[model samples]
Target: MKIHSIEAGNFKLDGGAMFGVVPKSLWQRTNPADSNNMIDMAARCLLVENGDRLTLIDTGMGNKQSEKFFGYYFMDHIYDLDSSLKKAGFSRDDITDVFLTHLHFDHCGGVIEKKKNDFYEPAFANSTFWTNKEHWKWAIEPNAREKASFLTENIKPIEESGQLNFIKQNSSFATQNEMDFDILFVDGHTEKMMIPHITIGDKTFVYMADLLPTAGHIPIPYVMGYDTRPLLTLDEKSKFLNEAATKGYYLILEHDPNNEIITVKHTEKGVRLDKSLTFNDLFN
Candidate 1:
């Protein structure tokens, strides 16, 4: 199996929101913020090519929202889904499956697109969109806290398209039926969020998703403010990190701007960032 780093684009998010209760002095050292208190973020997606199936995991926030809506995030267009796919020697039509980690806008927005005459449809018509039944329900009936992130334009179209499918949900991990990977279901970030654990050769590459957005979040206390259950997140992080450190897993971060893949070690301060490597450095 081959893995490709599909960079959707870059955007800026409030550093305070990203780091939660952590002080700026602490987080800023790793993810330095601008004068506006905004930190750089990447909608870094992943593509897996195994046999005849090409699976794209998480499409970055697609350019379908209004300019006013996008202005809030300060999006940079140096890299987008199309160009990144092209660089990977593929196209949207080539995607046979789209495995969404969750239904958050940044992660699933690129799956649907806005078209002429105000028509909305699945961006990858040839692909079977994947999400868990629990998440699909939670997203469609979103709570006030996460309503803004679950846009109607980004979601409704998938169900309407008749191409949406759900991976069977289970207690902790779910076995992916089609893709060559097992899923780790996490809830602190969102309901039934599926983090793919793909084994390629002798190494295991985990799509970190929001469970560990960046290497800076290696500390158990450094949970994102966006997480609904911060306490649950702390517990989840502690358990996952210890296991990952023990197994030597290469974590593929989705939201980290500079660092893509990171390895953690069992340090006195708990599991700490051991090394930061680029996608090419390891995968290539």
Candidate 2:
């Protein structure tokens, strides 16, 4: 199996929002803010080439939103999805499965695109988009706090296309015959965000969707403010980090602008960042 780091694009978000209650004095040391107090974030996605199946995890924020809507977030360094896929030696049609960690706009917005008369359609027409049943329901009928992040234009088309499938949430190690990876479910960030635990050769790479957005968030208290239940996130992170440290799992970070992959170690202060490496470092 081969994995490629696909750069969808970069955008600006309020550092305070991204870092939560973590004081600017600390988080700013790693992710510095601009004059407007917004920090640069990457819509980094992963592409898995395993035998006959080509699976993509997360789609990033697509370019279908109006200028006014996008202006709020300061979307920049825009890399078109088709071009990125082409650079990776694949196209939209080559993707057989799209495993979405969650349905937030920044994560799944690129699944659909705007056509000539403003009609929206699935970007990867041949792909079977995957989302767990709980998350699918939570996203579609979003609560007031998360409603803005779950846009209908980015979601409804997949269901309308009849290619959407739900992974069974019966257990943390839910297995799908078609997928080589096992699903890890955590509810701290959203309802049932599925983190893919993929084994490639001798190493296991855990896709850190939002549970651990960046290495800076490695320290126990550095949870995101966007998380619905912050205390639950604390408990979840503690357990996951302990296991990740013990097993030496390579974490595939989705939003870290500078770092791509990292491994953690159990320190006196609890689990802390160990080493930051590139994707090639692991595969080479």
Query: In terms of TM-score, how similar is model 1 to the real structure?
Result: 0.96
Per-residue lDDT of model 2, residues 1-284, tens digit only: 78889988888888899889999999999889999999888888999887788899999998899998789888884676788899889999999989899999999999999999989999998999999888999999999999999998988898998999988975443233534587888999999988888886678899999999888889888988899988999999999999999999999999998899999999998998899999878777
Model 2 Cα displacement at 201 (Å)? 1.8
Query: CA lDDT, every prediction?
Result: 0.90, 0.88
- lDDT string for model 1 (1-284, tens) is 68899999899999999999999999999999998999999999999988788899999999998898889999988899999999999999999999999999999999999999889988998999999999999999999999989999989999999998888865323234333487888899888889899887678899999999988888999999999889999988999999999999999999998899999999887899999999879766
TM-score of each: 0.96, 0.95
Model 2 alpha-carbon drift over 4 Å, by segment = 170-179
Q: Give the TM-score of candidate 2.
A: 0.95
RMSD of each: 2.0, 1.9
lDDT (C-alpha) at residue 57 in model 2: 93
Residue 33 C-alpha lDDT in model 2: 94
